[model samples]
Target: MQITIVSGKGGTGKTSLAVSLAMTLENVQLLDADVDEPNCSLFLDLDTKLVAEAKIPIPEINYDLCTLCGACSSNCEYNALMKVPDQILVFEKMCHGCGLCSKICPENAITEVPRTIGYLYEGENKEFLFNFGSLIVGEELSTPVISQLKQLISKDKPIIVIDSPPGSSCPMVETVIDSDYVILVSEPTPFGLSDMKMVVKTLRILEKKFGVVINKDGVGNEELELFCQKEEIPVLLKIPFDLEIAKNYSKGVPFLNVLPEMDSKLKKMIVDIGEALE
Candidate 1:
């Protein structure tokens, strides 16, 4: 089974929980799909290697065969192409690599070329297989890189844990959409509740099965729990606001290492998720 761990916003211990949960499970494949800021590797000691480069096809204008016909520019949804009187300008960063510009070009002056947008890394130890993607600086879109990362998922493992990007945007959606289950990690604060609501709405729209894990549970008001109760959303586990957990996290340590007691809880959460899936 594939399980994606995500949050409504950053700094909510999403990656930390994902890594800990992966370590708790057996025969797992862990994938960090947060291309823009993949930090899951920081918590694990794996000899990772650059396995593949994530690329997207961008339209390349061939001036030799070209008439500066406005067809390519007009059809571009991202405004990556612009037609000037003398020539056509291609803005590489803005392109979504949809290949529409090339297809619409009447003169066949546009050709698609692969542009490296990110890198994919793979690492394995006796515990589990690991993969993560890192977006190149100045890249506007992350969904393509995430798409390439998901392609590396080896179904050979019995369990797959995906560390997804925060928020309800395209990148996060792309990461969790195909998962068998999603674990939404949120704090109990007001901002956390607000953002989690947005993610809840998105998951409901996508018809995805998900549960909540309230991190830093002691600080926030009871409203978050009340909301979850009213919505009938399952509360899987709660990690209390503790100083040792914070300190370990700062030192790039998984909470499971210092708080061995929580390992059983994490395992039970997975078992609960399996029961729910059935």
Candidate 2:
């Protein structure tokens, strides 16, 4: 089973909760799909070694062999290619590696070239199998990296925990897609409620089974709980705001490592997820 842990916005303890939950499970595979900013490896004591490099195909124009045709530019849905009078300008960052530009090039001037965008790392300890991706800085696209990370891992594990990126954007959707269940983490603030609503809407549209985990539970906003109740969504867990937990997390320690009592609660949450699937 693949359970993707995601949030509507950032700084809602999504990664922290995901790492802690993975720690509670036995012989699981933990995938940090937040390639733009993956931090799960920091909390793990295992040695992460770079296993593979994630590359995307970018268009390379052969100026000498071609005419500046507008066909390639018109075919690119992302507008990554611009046809000037003299040449075709390529925006590497905007390219989605669709190969449409090459296919539509009348002059046969466009060729697909591989560009390394990220690195995939893996670490295995007795507890669980760890995998994650680190996107190159200034890379606007993380969906490709997330896809490569998921594709590289074998789905033979009994349980797989995916730490997804924040928001209901393409990268997050890519990470959460094809999962057995999704766990949306949020806080008890107005911003949290708003973002969580958007994420909930996304999950509903995707028709995926999902639940909510309210982090920083002591905060004085009842709106989140009310919304969940009204929507009939299960509140799987409530993690109270703790200063020690914050301190440990800042130092790259899992909250469950400092507060071992939460282990049973996390295990129960997993059981609840299993029951929900049933």
Candidate 3:
């Protein structure tokens, strides 16, 4: 099953839930798609092999091919190509790498060339497969790399845990695409509950079944319970606000192993989510 863990915003214990869940399932493939800050590997402690380095295709134009008749520029949806009186400029940033400009070019002047966007790593820890995709720091568009990473996943696994980047934006949506179920992780604060609503909307939009797991459950007031009660969304499992667990997390340790109840909860949570998906 492809179970993606996402949050409405960052700092909501998305990775913590993901890593803990990964440890519980044997022969699971764990994907850390938070390209900006990939902390999931901090806990996995696996040996990695370079899988693939992601790149986007940008159209390079040959000027001497004669006419700048504006056909290429006009066909570009992203406006990456603009035709001046005698010249055409390629704006790489705006390019979506669709190759439409190259396809529509009458003069055969346009050719697609790869430009680096990110890197994908594949590794293993015992029976579990660990893979992650990382985008370049200045990359404004991460959906391309994220999509590429999603395609590289091993579909034969009994279980898969994808650590998606926070929020309901393009990157997060792409990460959760084709998922069997989504585990929405959040805290119990107002910000957490508010953000949870946004992701819940995203789930409904995608028509994906999901459950919310309240991280740092006992730290905040009981408004989350009220919200869940009203919405009828199941509370999967609550990871409490414990200092030792925080310190262990801060120092790079798996909480589920230390707190045995969490492992059992996560296992049961997975079973419960599977039933919901079914």
The prediction achieving the highest TM-score against the true structure is 1
Please list the C-alpha lDDT of all candidates, in the order they appear: 0.93, 0.91, 0.87
Residue ranges of candidate 1 with Cα displaced over 4 Å = none
What's the C-alpha lDDT at position 220 in model 3? 79
lDDT of 1: 0.93
Greater lDDT among 2 and 3 belongs to 2
Please, what is the TM-score per model?
0.98, 0.96, 0.95
Instruction: Give stretches of model 2 more than 4 Å off.
Output: none
Score candidate 3 by lDDT. Answer: 0.87
- The count of backbone overlaps in candidate 1 is 0
Candidate 3, residue 1: lDDT = 92
Query: Which candidate achieves the best lDDT against the true structure?
Result: 1
Better of 1 and 3 by TM-score: 1
Candidate 3's residue-wise lDDT over 1-278, tens digit each? 99999999689898988999999988889989888777898887777888898899999988888388999888888888898887899888889899988888888988899998899889986788988888888876788888888877886888889999998998899999889999899898989888889999989999988888888878879998889889988889888888888889987897886698887888888889888877
